[model samples]
Target: MGQFIQKTSFSEKDFLAFQDKLHQCLEALELVLERPGFGLGEPSIGAELELYLLDGEGRPVLENQAVQDTYDDPTLTLELNRYNLELNFTPLPGTGAPFTALQQQILDNLAGLNQKMDPWQGQVLPIGILPTLQERDFGPQVMTDLPRYRVLAEAVQQRRQSTGIRIEGQDSMNLVHDDVTLEGACTSFQIHYRPRGQDMVNLWNATQLVTPLMVGVSANSPLLLGHRLWHETRVPLFCQSIDGLNSQSEHPVPPPRVSFGQGWLRHSLIELFRETVQLYPPLIPILSDEDPLAVVAQGGVPKLEELRLHDGTIWSWNRPIYDPCNDPHLRIEMRVLPAGPSAADMAANAALFIGLAQGLSEDVEPLLSALPFSYARTNFYRAAQHGMGASIYWPNAHQNSLEERSLAAVLEQLLPVAEKGLIQVGVNKEEAQTWLSLISDRLQSGQTGASWQLQQYNRLVGNGHGNHEACLQLLKAYCHHSNANVPVAQWPDL
Candidate 1:
């Protein structure tokens, strides 16, 4: 979804042509994977940080274009909503304190945005979802003025046959809408891990198995549209926004665009690609002119644009990425992390995830094998609802019982595995301690961002403050602590 297209609406002929090119691209990918040393070499780390643009009063600001133009930086770009922006990072090798380096870049970019927003009274906030958001804010008029976004909204709406998108968490958020613009309400800090000389299928499956555990510790979004919902309401909000038909209909129901996955990868990435092509219909079918097979036949890398574009449409929590261009490596995109509380907090979350992935991948038995995929899937949603308070089932190292344990207890045991994993992946012991220790303290303190926000919000509401007014006050306090560069666990309650 990060990529762009020349047009929005597609004709039948255009779709057919695009499908043909997509098949050719898949064939090229297969041929490329067959070569020895394919996607080999050093691992790299990268990320995409999505942000919200807020006004002086802590409300969403629809001035992204002006802010983007004034701050003319290549790393910054527009998101699905006009009030949203994204910051991208150049891939760096997974050695040293890459998380620190990434954090520094984010701070610098954030400072630049702050400076540019000063004149317009627009401020940049790193958050999962703006607390001040209202249903009225999601009208089609507020969407980014991009044809591709419009086409997506129309397509999702068409597939639903005008049925409203509905999600029920702690508070039910239902929308009788005609488009998928509700997705724009969510923001995330997406971390990318490029593995080198490793079995990507196993790494991906392992990541999926542990994603619920990660979400449990990193939950940050506790409020949406003044409603107290899940720790990360973005999960259900995003899934329901683009949801389509079910099996009860005339046609078989394909998985939701935003999904955990159908099942673990059986053969390799090829199975993923084949499933995508067969399940999802093309939305942006603007075909590329380059013949991928011809380029590969001449010992050259071909940009599998069709395959990538299609892959982007499937919003798997953990997605497989194929970079046949400049980087020329295969990477796993961890889409479970949310934005903000602080840069240090975000980096700690990243450290925990990458380290856990690396450490867990080293085990002789895959984590997925030990835990059922359905259990993993269930754990993800449960964690989303209950955050650290949730009791999640894990394959115990000592016993054969299928008993459930608190997320805190699970993290206590898993944190060491992540620390070892980071060290194993060339991260200095000091650097790993610097970041991973924050997560450890958070677990011990029982002060995840979500918990902090919910407690503060409840306190303010109890003090006779209206929901809207209290949210604004909370945002102001959040900004103060976030800019202080302290981990969220250290933040004071209202």
Candidate 2:
């Protein structure tokens, strides 16, 4: 969805010329919101990460096109599996030491993809779900040959008539596939956040009421194919892997193109790109010659590329982008963290989401009218199945209702409201207390990254080591404690 389409078989006249260039890119986003100095004047931050390409015994290594033809960099790319790979960094400016320059640009592009996967032994891991993944490693001949990922696995397996695709927590799956290439087994790190003028819908509803306290202290995937499911099995294996296409007769209950929405967005931000072009349908209608209303009637700034390829197939954990390059901002991606156990635990989960998105975008518009988008979508799947032992439901006040609490009493009342929203956005209160003290020492040592990968996979299966050699010795001690950048609460325990 990062633009690049010539063909993948779209035709109904290419979905009526991409719904007439997605209604002229929603009338050039209401003429760039009646132009009053568009975005990027200060708050800026970015990331993408998404790794996993292992081999030397820790499985899955599709050579990401020979490490993108031997890593010629331009922020690398390709992902939708071929053993995945995605980097994309540049944005930066949300105040000093920007997470130590995005953790030294992700350890200098993970040491240049570990020196080009060392003569093809191929390693580069950064995980979310790769505990030796398998189920015949997600079929469709290991996807990523790309024609827009085979027209998005043939439009989400032709809108689910292919059926079977189950997932339940503590180990349970179900199959039947033709191709949504099991959503390339899941991988994420995705942060973004631009937020300038009109504090972008109160920092997108304070990032949807703090995505379950940033997926409950950033739970990494707690093992999948080797069972031991959800601490964050990539959040219901990425919302039941590309589900959607079960029209089973009646209509109107729509909204599950992988979501935690259907409420709260009390108006403009073009009502989430007009409810994603009025509720999905064009999983890749390809055609985009870009005329976002003749480039905003020639004043310039268009690239809405069919409303950013139909809002990049809507897997919204907290999406709503719109980046027409050169100072044309409007961000808020934050797709519920989860990438690795390191780069300082993904820059302390991006400094607890840029200090709770600048301390709840300045008092989240009257605490979003006393919160209740169904308790922030049921506190995001109960913090993706109990990571930090879930219990959520916040917004207190002499208990007028929603109480529940405990992710250490909601990180002791939001880590001093994300360190006074990272020292009111210019950060540097000792670089926002060194990445919010690694989320307050991973919430005072509760140790998350899925509780240190379920306590080092049950202490390497209680010292005997079985389940695929204890998930390749917990992926070789989680790549030597994520290449020694450390942070999963000081690692060591296993």
**Residue 157, candidate 2: alpha-carbon lDDT:** 70
Instruction: List, residue by residue over 1-494, the lDDT tens digit for candidate 2.
Output: 75566577766887987887787788888898777787747887899988888877888888788888889886788898798889989879887778889989999898888888876565787888888887888887888786778777777776764365555766676666545666677788998867545567777887788888888888888888788877887876665567633532234345567777777787577888888888877678766566677778888888777778778887888888877777786778887787887887798788887688678776777666667787777788888888878887777534566567776677767887887887787778888777888888878888887878788888888888888888888788888888878888888765
The CA lDDT of each predicted structure is 0.82, 0.78
Find the candidate with the highest lDDT and give its number: 1
- Model 2, runs deviating above 4 Å: 1-11, 38-127, 130-153, 156-178, 187-192, 197-309, 314-320, 323-329, 332-347, 352-431, 434-436, 439-464, 472-487
Off by over 4 Å in 1: 1-4, 244-252, 364-366, 397-401
Worst 10 residues of 1 by lDDT: 244-253
TM-score of 1: 0.95
Scored by TM-score, the top model is: 1
Residue 361, candidate 1: Cα error in Å is 0.5
Instruction: Provide the RMSD of all predictions against the true structure, rounded to 1 decimal.
Output: 2.1, 20.5
